[model samples]
Every structure is written in structure tokens, then in C-alpha cells.
Target: MTANVNIAIKHTSLLISGALLGLLHAGLANASGYPVTVQSCDRQVTFDHAPKAAVSNDVNLTEMMLALGLQDHMAGFTGVSGWKTLDPTLRNGIGELKELSPKYPSKEVLLGADADFYFAGWNYGMRVGGGVTPDTLAPLGIKVYELTESCIHIMDKPKVSMDDLYIDLLNLGRIFDKEEQAQSLVKGYQEDLTNFQANLTPLKTIPKVFVYDSGEEQPFTSGRYGMPTALIEAAGGKNIVDDVQKSWTQIGWEAVIDRAPEFIIIVNYGDVTAEQKINFLRSNPAFKNIPAVKNNHFVILEYIEATPGPRNINAIKRLAEAFRTAL
Candidate 1:
């Protein structure tokens, strides 16, 4: 080969090696500070990298993932349409990703999707010893992150608060590498809540509110540890059943009537419509003495709003407005 050609070949090789080294350095820089650990319920889960294919259970949890702009990371979601119909906003936010299961998915479902992570909670998707759980899925190479609010099911937790929802968002952000987005959204929610609270008229008497979830023989209601209790207190009202000491539970009409709630929040979901639930309450002679039923003071909150999710802010706003007008 000519000397000139040999020199050109060596120069080209050197340039190619330099380019490869530069790309390697860039990759390392990007990968720095990975392998982060975050708290999930009672467990400490560590993520070596962001999940490529994750599956969130239920409408609220799924919305949490979507809020962080992590839709592309999801394989699909489950445990929504089986019970409550999706609101337009939730539908649009999820885009074209399909529901893997209309209800709680089986173990095979997650495996079929090749999901690397599962976002679920106790009774949200998996029961305490159900077929699908963190222990069950861990063997199959799927990491599970339990919802912060639902942690009360298995572990001792503080009284339910808006912070429960915020904690989930922050943990999800850490897991999915969307910390900035999560922090911004949480700050906005906090600010909006603060601003709304600031304009409130200090009530000499805070209205007593009761949440009617669903039940025929026994009325299902929210208690001290339920999300509704926190929402109610935030909206300048007290959940009449806050003394119940459980999250969601069924109680006798006598307890409800004894409390004499001034306002009732109907949870809209399942086969039984919110109107039917209210109608039953209004027509029942036994409950006629209750302040809420007597005055026909009631407002409906979607299942999503009653649960822990982004809709909580709007739910609090709506409840505050309803409380003001109902009295």
C-alpha cells in the first residue's frame, strides 16, 4: 500500500476509536446514580434501572403512573372497567394502551405481558393471600410496589391523609425516573389545596359528613383510615364515622342516624348507580330523622375521586363547595 493510504487508514481508525470512547463516557454519565431504593409499604424495593414494562392495577394507581408521563413504560393496566366505568379524562390520559384485565389479573397475565414491575395494593388488585402478590410475583422476576394508602391493610399506618397520595407519587417518580414531574405535580396540588382552604369561611360548626359507598342491608362507609375521611376533613367537614377505626367498612343505619350527618357524599361506582343509593336513602323512613336525609343534602363523588389519586384535589374542591351551598 502507498504511504499516504497507510497514513489515512491509521487516522480513520484513531477517529473511530475516539468516537466509541466518547459514546461510552456519555453512557456512563447518564447511568450515574442509578440503583435507587424506595419504600413500598413494608418493603424496601431497589430499582437497578427504570422499568421498561410496568403494569399498574386499578384506575387510581394507573392514573398515578400516567401522571408521571410513564405511560410508555406500562405494558397495560388492570382492575378498572370491571367495576367503575372510566371517566373521559382518565380515558384520554391513558391514550391507546389496552386494559390487560378488566379485573385483577392472574399471574399468567403479567407473565404474558413480560411485565417487569407491578403497581398494586391490598384488595386493590391482590388480596392478602391472593394468587397475585409481591411474594408470588417476585419469583417470576416481577417487582411489586404497594400503594401507600392501602398499606394500612397489612401494616400499621398513620391516619389517612393527602400525604398518602403524595407519597405514592413521589415513590413512583423515583422508581420511574420522573422525580421532577412528580415533585411539580405534588407542589401544584398542595398549592391549590392551600389556596382553596385560605378562602374558606371559618366554620363555627364544621359540617358532619357521611360517605355512602355501597350496601343494602348494611351501609358501607368511610372511617378514620379511609381516603374520604381525609378529604372530608380537608373540605372543612368531619366524617361522622371517623370513630369507626377502620378504613372502609359496613355499619348499621343506627350508627349513621345517631351521628346525624349534615351532608352525605355518595360514592358513584359498581352496578348500583349513585342516584339509586341516594334514592334509597331519601325514601327510607328509618333514616328520615337524619339531618342529611331530612334536608336532602347530598353530593356524588366518582369512585376515582373517593379513592387516592389525582382526582382527590378536585374532589376536595367539590366537597368544599357542596358543604358551603348545602348549609
Candidate 2:
């Protein structure tokens, strides 16, 4: 994690103190609510008691569970090491736990772990019509809380917004009986974003930007519905492909040339290095005249930061600074 991002609740002032702090432990789990039901995407899942053995998938969701101090309740984590390497901050939080699988776990893999609760989302761990959806796991006695941002894959949903991130945190708090911690983090994030935006230098005009996720023949990036759209908008920039109705999808290089973005946000992860991706754009004769390429105006946002996670606040701050510098 970057110096600006706090994986744990770092703002002591934003958190509760005195007697209210007592609820953070397992002793008062019922204080939040038992048999509590919360909406998860299209369904209302009920939790009779706080989940004792939870398994989170992907770096972002796992970080969220860790951020709320739910590692004690977790049996293990899966779907990280296959793609992105864990940074030092993540190592401190997840190193102690078991990694059930490197990538998406099979039903047998999840079942073998004896996980009572599966915190995942569509394509994040479970895919639509794949073996590991809420429907498939229900009969096996495992409950799931789908990531709000990933809901776009299965159904028509609202455009990506910061509230999508907050909703996941709030729902997870309700599910795990950590209302105080969840509320504290959400409140702090909201206030931080509001204050940061209010104090930001006014841009003469919002710059058009393209997110280079990972693809050469066709660029894969966040559309109007992907999390980066909200991130870019929050940072006083616009996603060049926001008009696309899909979320994360592949686009033709011709379309990119048509849009001619002034700045590029590189999604750094997977086999390709950020430096290599930059070199591709810089050396390609086809992209020679693009303003972003010509001016070398680019910002590298980590996969975790570009996706839904605690790092988003700082990611926006970084993008805001980069945008200002580029202009």
C-alpha cells in the first residue's frame, strides 16, 4: 500500500471511543443485531449469528474484511497470489491466514476449507452461470455477500459511484456484526473525500482520460459502469469510454484514436509491468499523435486502488494531483 492509504482504521479521531469501543469485540456481537438480514444484490440474505468461519476472495474484498478487523472471523482468503503480489501492508494483515487457492476456487476447494461464509462477487471469484455463485453455494450451507460493484455482470444496475464502495462496507459490517467499525470507516472516507474535493484546485476543464487495464490487440478497461469511472470523475477527469453501457470490456484501438484522450490511467497488475505498458503506448507508431502519448501524461493506479478497496480514497488523491500536474 502507498503511504497515503491506510489499510486499517488509522484515523483514531474518526472512530468511536469510551464504552462504544467495547462493541468492536466478539463479546458484543449481538449488539449490532442477530438474525439480521441485509440486501445482497438481488436477494435478502439473513445471518442468524455473526459468521464464525468466513472466506473472502480477491485482494479488494479481502482488504475490506481485514479493514473491519474481521481476520479473526476468517478461516482463510483466496484469489490473490495468482495475479497480484501482496504488498507489505497486505502481508501484515493476510500473511497469517491460509490462502485456500491462488485464483478462483472450485466448489471442492471452497468446500474443503469448511467456510461458512463466502465474501465474493461476480467474476471476482464466482462467475455468472459458473460453478460458484450464491445459488450453487446455498445448498452447501455457505452464505455469500456479492460485491456491489460486481453486480453489473448479472443485472442492469446503477452507474458506478463511490456509494457502491460504501454500500459494500456498510453491508459487510451488518453481516459480520461490526457496525461501529464499518460506520467509522465509512464516515471517515466520506468526510475525507468531501474535504479533499472541496480543497482541490479548480480545473479549467475536465481532461478526457483512458484506462489501460491490460490488452494489446484490444484494450480492456472500465466503461460507464466500472469502478474507475467513478474514480476518474472523483479525480476531476472523465473516462473516455464512459459512454459504453458495459462495465469492464474490450474496445477497438480505432475507438481510442477517435476519442483521443489527453491523459491515461494505467491499471498496473497481471503479467505485464506498468513500465512495459507505457513503452507500448510510447513506441507504437499508431499512437504517435495522441495527446497523452505525446505529452507523456499518465498515472499508474494499482489494481487494488483502481478496483473497490480502502486504497480508493488515496487513489483519487493521487489522480487529482497527477491531473493537476499534467495540466
Candidate 3:
């Protein structure tokens, strides 16, 4: 009976030891700061820690990181086309970085760089191109963050708003443990927006505005949901293309003439210059007769500032101020 009692106590102790081990593992897993899984657009991404060595595939992501004061963490960058109107400092900094391939880096290159995490404006850079799928990177202990705005199918036609831009800044702040800096920047932006709106002369009427992005084959126009609409509303004008539901849409020149916008914003992308756009419009038989062209009310905005990101608010303010002066 004494021997049986000893065995029983030993078994009990063994069970307790196993339980303790399990609990210890759970604690460690919880303490490791494993990223909270969130569904973005079409996929699930796990951001394990504050990204130390980062790469930005989109111009807006780079702008957001710069705004958050996390520029030092950038490893390499792509998407330089958006910086046309940016401050010289930013444009020069990007010019100095190695041109990142449109696709993800190779496994050998990725491993050599030893990047802690990757941030991209869109997921296509990760999933389709190169062998940099999430599974491949995960085994090497790399994390990726895709911008919420880029996650289109997940949300019901996400409308790009200044509020979304501010939230993105806050999210980056939380990820990088720079909450205070992010808050300060966001607060300042809010103040700027509020002041701009309040001091503005009440518009007796909002002007009809047309935003033209890239187009030779198909003209890209902003729809009700994205940076274009936000820009139009913020600029104290109406987006003639607001009825279109997509972020970008293609329409006939007849439609533009039918609406007869009072002001036109021409967006220049990559090597394209504003002068080229003006020339194109002037030379084109269809666009030359528009009231905006006749009145010389066309303004040039770089493609970067026209996208959804931190710089968007500034773009809106500048455009609004310009329109106020023009009126």
C-alpha cells in the first residue's frame, strides 16, 4: 500500500509538472508580442514587432513613414513617381536610396539584408510577383504590413478620407512605438485643416471641378470613393466624376464636356511634366474647348500628393487655398 501511495503521488506530480510547462509556454507566447492578426483587404498579415528594417513599395507608405518620424527605419524604397511635388529633402532622400524592384527581393537578397519587416502600399507586390509570398517570408521570420487603403475587396469600396490618413499615421505610430510623435503630428494636421476651413470665405457656390490623372488610352478619373473626392470636397469644389463608384474610372471626353467643370486639375505621373499635360490638352481637339481650358483655370498636382496618404491633407489645403485665390 505504501508503494502504491508513492506511485500515486509521483503521477500527480508529473501531471502538475506538465500543466506548469504548458502554462509557462502560453505565457511566453503571450509575452513575445506576436502581432494581433487583422484582416486587410484580401489577406491576413502578422506584424510581429516594431519594424526595424523596412521597405516601402508605395509612395504613400514612404510619405507616411516620413511623417511618423520613422524614416530612419527604412531599408530600401520603391515608387518614386509620387514625390514630384514633395519637399526637396524627401525627394532627394528617395533619390539617394537604391531603386527597389517593382517586385519583392529574392530570398538570397532578402536574407542578406536581414530586414525585420516589410511594409507595402499594396499586397500584389508580395503575393504575385517574385517568390516573396507570405509563406516564403514567414519561414525566415519576416512580417509584412499592407496598407488598409490598399485592401479594397475587404472593405466595401473604402473611401479615402483625411480621417483614414490620420488613422494610418496612428497605426504606424502604434506599430513603431512612436505614439506620442504620431499624435503630435496628427494634432498639428488637424489644427491646420480646421484653421484653413474656418478662415476661408464662405463659398457662395462650390465650383465644379475635374481631376485628370493619367490617360492616353483610357483617361483615369477619380470616383466617389478615394483621394480625388476627398481632394475635391476639401478644395471647396465639387467632383464632376463623383457619381463613379470606383476609385478610378474611365470616361469619354463627351462626359467631361457635358459636366463642364469650372476648374481642372492635371496630375503628372513619372517622367510626365505639367507642361506636357497642358500641351496635350491644348492640342487635343476634344479638350481644348473646355471652359477650364478657355478660362486658364487648370492646376497641376503631382501624382504622389493625389494618392491616399498623409500628404493628401496638405494637397487639399493647398488646392483649396489656390481655388479661393482664383475665385
Candidate 4:
């Protein structure tokens, strides 16, 4: 097997083990209570009781909540990324909530909503400039749970894996007292993953792939670790810049030419069309001669799906299909 496939197999195995361990621990935890304190994102948040009203600051949290069938408990949402495509019912609900603005309702609005709990996908939304701090919300009897994968600077280090997605689902299930529903959802995801894996053919070779995301002045590319690496492997391609440790890194034009990737996935963000992306690459003197450009083997995916979350599975499938067709 190629190195990328080996890496993917090893990574998937480790994630499975870690997920099993996590599920075991979660199973043993005391479940009988009005509320529980779960440590996430380097913070200990005690949910004194099952929250009746809640607000989400990130789309992942919203997705998780809706998946857990806890939408009825959601009071509002703020700072959601515009890239995500939500379920029709959830989108309509958000529209109604926006019209209401029932309480604290700004990108900076975190208080005055009188929500019993606050769940954020990224802690950056609650940091200094984020309009609401945990301390400020705590005084009003509101608690916050920040998604562990998005936590950047934590000493103890939360383990992140593809399984963390399922763990997040289960955790939300616990919070909403929908354990059965959560299990069912996790099972469905596992089945989806299994089906995808079964469809995988033993790779004869790992195709070279380049991930071009937003960056007009300086291009952003996936590094060795994190979501992009996972996505690349899943798509049956190898990231040209996989030696770097960071999730993403800036690389010069010369390095990209040297790699000479066979396929390029241009991550579409904010008002950028696929044709515009192709034009941008063709206009770049440095990239004009690359095989990807010459062969027109470029694909565009939404920025939100490219990030880590439930949408990542969709991104992987789309990417795999795109590469398969191009190859």
C-alpha cells in the first residue's frame, strides 16, 4: 500500500480505539442527575440542570443540537458561519429567531438572552472581542461548552479524531437527555463511514493533490496534520505539502511547482465562483504550467464543508468522486 493509505489506516485505527475508550468512560459516568459537569475545551462547565433554553454561536453546535433533536430547546444562535447549509426546518427556525431577536443578539451579543446554557463551536467567539466572556455569562447562570477540536491553546490537550465528531454527537445527546437518539445517529454515521471504506479500492498509487483555500496575497495550503490531511487521504490523494506540522501553512510558488500536483481542490469561500478560481490560477504566472492547470483538473468545494465537522464526510465523498472522475 502507498504511504498515504497506510497513514489513513493507522489514523482510522487509532481514532476507533480512542472513540471506544471515550464511549466506555462516558458510559461509566454517572448519568442520573439534573445536570452534569463535563470538562471540554479546557473549561469545567457545570450544567446545574437540563437546560431549557440555549443559544449556539457556531454552526457545528447548531448541527449537533439539531441532530440530537434538541432544537426545541434552542433559544437562538449567533456568529454562525454563512458557508454552512442547514436543514430546511432549522434554517426557517433561524430566520424566525433572527426576526425576533428575542434578547442578546449581536455577533457580540452573548448576554440578555437569558439562556440557561451557551454552546460554541469555537471559543474565539467568546473571547475578548467576541462580545461575551464566560465570566460575564456565568454571573447570569449561563454555562458554556466550547467544542474541543476548535480549542487552540490548551495544556491538557483534548484528543481530536474523526471519532470526535461522533463523541460530540453523543455529548450533545447526554446534555439534551436524548441518549437513545444520539446512539442512533452515531450508528448511522458509523455505517456511512463503513460503506465509504468498503467502497475504497486498494490504491495502485497516491495521486498528488493541492488544496488552495482563501488567500489572495499569500496562498493557504493544508499541512501534515489536522482536517486537510484527513480529507486528502480520504479522497485517495496525497497532500503535496504534508511534511509541515501545522494544520495549514503558507508556502511559496516555487515549492508548489516543484510538487507538481496532478489535481487541485480550490476551496471556495465568500463570493468566489469556480470559474473565478480557475482564472485566478491560470493568471498566476507561477502556476500556469502545473499539470493541474494544464489538464483543468481543478474542483471547488465550499469552505465550511472543508473545515472539520459533520460536513467533512460530504467533503470527503465529493472530493473522492471528483478525483476519481479526473483520474
TM-scores of all predicted structures? 0.89, 0.90, 0.77, 0.81
- Winning candidate number (lDDT): 2
What value of lDDT does candidate 2 attain over all alpha carbons?
0.84
Please identify model 2 stretches exceeding 4 Å from their true place: 1-32
Candidate 2 residue-wise lDDT, 38-112, digit = tens:
668888898998888899999999999999999989989999999989767887987589989999988898789
The digit string of per-residue lDDT tens for model 3 on 56-88 reads: 666667777777777677677654533334447
Cα lDDT for residue 32, candidate 3: 39
Q: lDDT of model 1 at residue 213?
A: 96
For 1-327, candidate 1 gives per-residue lDDT tens digits of 233333332332222233223323333343445776777889989899999999999999999898889989999999998997987888999998889999999999999999999999988999998999999999999999998778888999877877788778777777877766776787788778777776665455678899999997999888989999888877777889888878888999888888899999999999999999999998889999999989989989999999999999899889888887776
The candidates, ranked best first by lDDT, are: 2, 1, 4, 3
lDDT of 4 by residue, 239-295 (tens): 888776555567776777888998888876556666787798888887878999989
- Model 3 regions lying over 4 Å from their true place: 1-39, 42-48, 81-87, 91-97, 102-112, 123-140
Question: Residue 212's C-alpha lDDT in candidate 1?
Answer: 97
Candidate 4: C-alpha RMSD after superposition: 3.7
Ranking by TM-score: 2, 1, 4, 3
Q: Model 3 — which ten-residue stretch has the worst lDDT?
A: 8-17
lDDT score, residue 269, model 4? 54
Best by TM-score: 2
Clashes of each: 0, 0, 0, 0
The 10-residue segment with the lowest total lDDT in model 2: 4-13
